[model samples]
Target: MTPLLTYLAKVVIVSGILYGYYYLALRNNRFHQWNRYYLLFCAILSLIVPLLRIPLQFAPEETSNSYTGQVLLLREQVFTPAAAAEAGRTDWAFVLYSLVALLCVARVAWGYWKILRLIRHSRLEFIRPYWLVLSDKIGAPFSFFRYIFWNSDSRFETPEYRKIFRHEMVHVQERHSNDKLFMEAVTALCWVNPFFHLMKAELALIHEFIADKKAVAGGDVAEYAQSILQMALQSRHDFQLTNNFSHHPIKRRILMLTASRRLRFSYLRRLLILPLAAIIFCSLAFVVQEQQVETRAAQTAPADTIKPPPPPAPPRPNAKPAKPVFDSGGNEVFTFVEIPPSFPGGEAELAKYLSTNIRYPKEAVDKNLSGTVFVSFIVSAKGKIDSVRTVGTKKGGGLEEEAIRVVKEMPDWRPGKQNGRQVAVMFNLPIRFTLAKPEKKGPDGVYTRPEKMPSYTGGEGELHQHLRSNIRYPKEALDKRVNGTVLVSFVVMPDGSLKDVKPAGDKVLGSGLEEEAVRIVNIMPAWEPGREKGEAIATRMVLPIRFSFQ
Candidate 1:
């Protein structure tokens, strides 16, 4: 999976586990406040646990293919959307994700707009530590940040009114609106995640339960239940980003309010499962390391069964390496080791990277100079390149400079290692600079279209068959599992001779892929020329040559 997809998958997994455990352990608990925080905690864990990483150190590989005289290519390539589209890339999944996310955002914005407009039209009734918006537009009571939206015509007695006022006041004081907003943001971001939506619904219901419990404190619970039923029978309304009195199921609210004996320390059950869940989650998040004793035994003995472990050897005066063991950056390095540094995809990818990225200097091409320049650098223990320089018999005409420039553009490589430990190693690369022979254009003018279009000797199928038969995947790219289609454009002259063959787009897929495509096109049999006014004419044509291993 792509990195983004992987991250989302992790989030989904974490949320599923936590949510499943909660439903089984604490879902029906009467401890509304504890349940509320725990649910929020689960949301936080689901969102953030995937981002945490625990680095585990281990012995390095016994055979690293790092600096085996290879250039490495980074998987990263920057392309503008125009360039990507030109290369025939269209990510429909990304489009869908963006569209859904935009809708969620618009929904949230609309909710805020409705709240603001209601507050603008309604008259404010000042209540100590909070305020109320009395509006006939609202059919039910709901609490926002510090403002409560109440029906101008309420059908409750003085005692019931006080109890209901306390309910909204509880939401305002405890800042449950912020929790709803946070829940909104999560659901919006992970709209496809059923657990997030479930969590949003669960959180809102929990908020109601919390308000009910606080509102009925030292008051008649039966009367409050009666008042809820009275409000239910009246015309109702609902809105988002607000604590609506009638938004949740009426029966569940009354039962939770009347239920006695809070689930005492239900968190204990959750805590018991946490360590086990954490252990499993951590195993996936953390890196596995090499065994310490096994590494030592592997370096010394042929068989682990026969050896008891050797004692430390005596220190020598020349214990330090004769050559510099550390680079200017203060990291330990090596001239040679069990494993040499390499590119991410190894030698083949290295070759592809160099061929694709290294461009011959304009000055050198103009002066018709070609040579091989030797470039050297350090591949650090962590696969970083440093200390880049060039050395060779051939130097001038900007050849050495260009070689150095491209080498410096390189990212980190697979670092060299010795005795199962990572160490930096020296890297050397030889880059060849050569210019292609410029093709001479025919005297006949190229035409976009004529009275008659050009035709292959046989048909389009035969032309494709010829390309498939003759074109070979570039060896360097093939070794590294590289594949792409090259769009080659050329002209069929009046006499049916092909000329000016080249890739047709701004995208340059190097590593000999384009060269192979061009080679196949140039060697094709001549086509029957286009015509205009009973006379043969040259016509431009574009052909797509695909190189797919599968």
Candidate 2:
């Protein structure tokens, strides 16, 4: 959802920048054809730029006095469940957006339907390479593709009629209907954005300016301006897909018609769009690339360095203990130690310390930014916490800085011992900052829905690892070569323990697959309970476990 929001924001930004540039640099220019193509190209580019994934290199900033540990351990994990029949959740926002867009589409279709109805009843006359449809329903002259609709009562022999026909003819010859149709589709898709409507209007105005110029070529500009004003007083059809002769700003059209032609060199202003587009593309792609690089670096670096050092031999029980050794990076490395480090009071105390000390940033709270921040640090041989830094920031809004600050302020722990000697050990902790309070509840006593769902102790990755390690393929199902996904439903209790674990559907995956899946889930470790508001709640979840023969 965050990535989708980011992509949409980029689309808006790119479109805004391109349209702004067009208004400033090329709006009043005499090169109508060039401006028309420029606008179309920009619209296409804005849609394409957000989908590009470009790799970029940036020098990571170094924190003061922070030594790089040989192994990186922290990571941010988000759980997004696959679509399931049991969840049956309706995304109301998406439904509303789709409904509005559909309304716009139906509105545009109605306009075309009106035009087609008029064509069916009117008399169609062949006029050179165009078809002139004479209809009483059309109050004014309009061109749709190669067909031009003129009022049946109009005086075709008059000079004013000739001028109007010529203007409509220019639209048909230029195929301006294609541009109208393109913008109509854009309007249907982006009806929520006012700028898109403005863009459509601007494109239409540009079309009029170009057609008006070509209509009066080698003739008097004042006469063409007069024809446009006279036609503006008459009624016009309200179809979106057609180019009506009087559908644009009369003053702008007249001014553009009489305005001095721009110098050829002035057309060079269109080239500015190249740099504008490149800047927008880079701005959108750089932020996404930076985040990807940070996540990849955190996961891959330390694991690559810590590749299972050979296990140390057991020390003699009666002999004096040997001191631990330091790696070339000046950080202590441990493979097999006599005793691992412990927090001041064990896991419960560590939890108490985090809950009591962690403060949610006001900025983050105001913006409703919530996610887990993974902080990695070292407990030195002297039991002091040092080298505090954030390895993974799932969602940034000063959350990472707050998490790092809280971790750095933590008291010293009991350092690990290797053969009775204190040794430094790397520690990773994930601190979740949520704005939800536990007191909030829906209509139901139990929270059927929550802002944040329950997860495993470490993260979703660890949950998968636990499942893979614990789940045993049933011999009956394996021997019969039965393979299918079994949906298991369970309630994650307020205390983060599983309850009511059972298969959602009866005998759905035969051969004991469903039974085996339910058994595996019941034996799983307690999860970090899901929360609604700020309070813990029992949330029901359904997971699909697959059984297959190797």
Candidate 3:
């Protein structure tokens, strides 16, 4: 069952249980009957609610795949292709309804079985005064025990036995047992319902009331009361189905039987049940319908799928001179451009290679051009790089130039593929630059740049190409059209070359692509470590990249 339907069922069950208890406690005759009717209504409604919700008609999935679309299309085309889907969904609802119905039937059957069990264990006997067969069962008072066999239990006083026999006969003649059997099945079906219990108890009380009145009509009330007392005082047998002359509130039953007052019936009281049931159903429907509307609204709300902002790029080492894109502030601007990628191994392998090779740049520290730069790059289907572009830049030492150099030198990256065909994808990178403090130690316990140099693993062509293809621009960043390089610097480990970088050159694209560029530069196939005495050494070089919208 759907969660919504399950919730509604729980509500029905709980409300029914509570209402059942309230009427039971009050014990008004009219209220008792009304409560039973109300319970019946709840059961019927619970079964029907899910059925009503089955979307018999719906909008075509081709036009739109949302709930609203389905609804609208249903109203329009009447017989859209989406009708099949709607039918399939409604079929499930029917299945659920069938299951709940089966459960209700099973529950009713169980109740009948229990009643039979109670009857089987009750004591059945024929006793005196009125010479009637009586079965004393403990569940609902005055109920006939179908499984009981009439017999005489020789343990009763003359008048006491007589009154008990008369009462039992009244029950038998009234066929109260059959009435209780029907009620039992209904109660069992709604067993989780507390109201069923109340109704059962009320029905039992009414059976006794009617019997008591009959017994006194042609007999003595005083004599009957005395006989009831005597039977209580005598040896009482606990039989599953033995009808005892006296059971529960004997004094009250005697008084009510003798009293000359007739129960007053008010038109208003009798009329209350129908309206109350209607109100309850209407309220439930309104609540559930309102919730459904809200759920449908949320599912149809528009979501923005525009690309994210470009990320910053990492600092590059000794970047070659290039046409500088700048702002009014004399600062360089690096515009993110798309590039193709080369995938020698695959996307997975490329990701691993990038993880292993990318590193921070050290020259950025010497130049003190440490900031975040956003770079954009593309990946081609054949694992090759077309171009790497930087968007933002940090000022000084051509920080943008440094970022571009690192990205341009990136190793070839594995291309991303969709359905066996190679597709150009854009990716973004952000590089951060931080100056090494004098207190910081380098390899060999000394500031040797070679031993701590950053290395690349795969072909530089592949990594560069992938970045260019996947890069995207941030709407806000593009809208501002801000152009200015924010040069960034970071150390490349092992080779101590420029790797990570952030550029403050331009805000035309968001910062994500710029950051992506930095990461790719850091992941390029390892460069031959700058050497000092043929030993691997780390060196720092600073280069700046440019950014400009095409």
Residue pairs that clash (backbone atoms under 3 angstroms), model 2: 71-302, 72-302, 436-533, 436-534, 437-533, 437-534, 437-535, 438-534, 438-535
Ten-residue segment with the worst summed lDDT in candidate 3? 68-77
TM-score-based ranking: 1, 2, 3
Query: Lowest-scoring 10 consecutive residues by lDDT in candidate 2?
Result: 300-309
Root-mean-square deviation of Cα positions for candidate 1 versus the true structure, in angstroms:
17.2
Q: What lDDT would candidate 1 get against the real structure?
A: 0.67
* Residue 25's lDDT in candidate 2: 80
Q: Report, for every candidate in turn, its global Cα lDDT versus the true structure.
A: 0.67, 0.66, 0.43
| Model 1, runs deviating above 4 Å | 59-88, 125-128, 155-157, 262-267, 289-385, 388-550
**In terms of TM-score, which candidate is strongest?**
1
Give per-model TM-scores: 0.57, 0.52, 0.34
**Model 3 backbone overlap count:** 164
On residues 1-550, what C-alpha lDDT tens digit does candidate 1 reach at each position?
Answer: 4445777888888888878877887786787787788779878888887776544544433432221111221111222223323334455776788789889989998998989998999999887768889987887688999999887887556888878878888899999999999999888888877898888898899998889889998888889998788877875664789998765578888898777775676658757666856775685667542221110000111000100012222334544322344666898666545445656444445555665566656677568776556576788888888888876476587877877787788767656667877888765555545454222223455665455667777753356346545655565654444444465778788898989898876566677878976887799898888777888877776654444332
- For candidate 3, give the lDDT: 0.43
Residue-wise lDDT of candidate 3 within 221-316, one digit each (tens)?
A: 888777666655654444322334556666666666666554455445545555665665554443211101110011111111112234423224
How much does candidate 2 score in TM-score?
Answer: 0.52
lDDT of 2 by residue, 1-550 (tens): 4334566677777788888888878887788898888877767776778886554423222211111112323232221111111124565766787899999999999998998998899999997788999987788799999899988989879877787888888899999999889888887976765666777888888889888887888888888788888788977658879998987688999989888875665846877677777777777655321211011111111121111112223334663433444533476655223344566544444655565555666677678787667687777887888777776435787888877887789788767665567777665665655565323234556554466667668754455455545665565554455555565777788998998888774447687767777877798889888787787888776664544321
